[model samples]
Target: MSLGSAFQTLCGALFEDSMTLVCSAVVPESLTKKYRNRMISPRDPYSIYQLDSINSSYLLVFHFEDMPDCRTIQLTDMHNLNCTSHTGEEKNLYFGYSHRMCYNYTLDLTTELKHHCGARGYEENMQSGYYYTNHDPNPDIRSDVSGGSLLGSPTLVICLIVSLLLIALLHWKTSRL
Candidate 1:
């Protein structure tokens, strides 16, 4: 699958800029069913999560496929959803473009991008190796993608209850001593 044309042009404009802006993407398909159920809505393809320190905020889109590199996140599109106006110009909250990546992750101005994308221009400088594939960009996509809270799980509650009971038992035993 591929992204629409409008989304691609917008991505190019944002990435071409050297300015650093903070943003994030919400990929609901990244979470497991159990964890997803704990979320407000599970498997929501359109959900967006972000924090903004700049006047611009871009939403990087991706499409998932089942292949050898099944988890590879193909850059699909970008949406200029920034609400803040700039330079005495009206904020463009309705612009988009299509883009793609052979890599597993979408690079952006966030801690996650810093961790995966190298100092080299994000789209260029692919390292040559005898045993490397585009999937190397993100070998474990599902590991940390979940937004659900662990404390909301039933197992954690059971563990908490058991711990409280054990503490109460210990208190009683100490009083008897």
Candidate 2:
């Protein structure tokens, strides 16, 4: 079977609903160059090997309503789908490598150029790996109690109570005088 057909079959079997293949291309030389000397382990969420025997590598991008199960994909020849990284609610990209002419896919979410894969049930998978590029209209703002509103801090509330007590004491003393 052609690599393209294999990918389509894999996706069809993996995802419950029909998904769209947004993009597919040969993995950029510049990107592959970065991993020339890097050691890739089977346990790693992503893998990049210097297999001179394989002439070319490809990157496949797919759009899905929900992420496919990482465990199920791990069972396939594609191996694990890096479940921790994602671009948006409905988009994911997979990095495929040629191993002895058969595609040995790896989930390369760490790459800066492409959107990462999302795994099932992992909340972190919903977050985009490219934080700098994310122009979130309603970004979450986290603040400590001290840095937040004055009424929200216990220390400030105690201080206000103490100040009020001190003022009452002073007023009572002046009225007595």
Candidate 3:
């Protein structure tokens, strides 16, 4: 049904090595290409204006070169999965064994522990709903985004009154002339 499932079937049929994982990570890269523009509004044909008078319309093309190499399972020397400390804790996960090499011995699981703890804390938020883009086609109906500047406060009211009076005065003067 899925790509992973198809891959599994193919691997089972052909290859001896067991298929492990297929993870994808995206990183932004600035790309530029030209194509035809198609943002025409059917409702208001007369309101259509040219972005560029010389150029008619163009499309932005983003090219994907190749599939990323992420099809492998790096075997680690995880001798013991379940381990315990000197003080005798309930249960411990054997992260990595200490090696007395020339390099620095920095084997701290505090980061990983904190990460898992934080993840657990966000269980409620995760259960709520999935995230979306700022420019999502169907934006949240409840949001009062407000396209332009809002007319609020006493200062704005006074300014508006003054403008109206000035306009009225100008019209009166023109009429008299």
Best-performing candidate as measured by lDDT: 2
Model 3 Cα displacement at 96 (Å)? 44
* lDDT tens digits, residue span 1-177, model 2: 875455545433332322222222233445546655132222223322111122122222222212222211211233223232233333223333322122334434433323323222221111111101111123233222255576687988999999999999999999999
What does candidate 3 score on TM? 0.18
Which window of 10 residues has the lowest lDDT sum in candidate 1?
125-134
Residue 19, candidate 2: alpha-carbon lDDT: 22
Candidate 1: segments with Cα more than 4 A from true spot: 1-65, 68-148
Question: Which candidate would rank higher by lDDT, 2 or 3?
Answer: 2
Residue 36 of model 2: what lDDT? 52
Ranking by TM-score, best first?
1, 2, 3
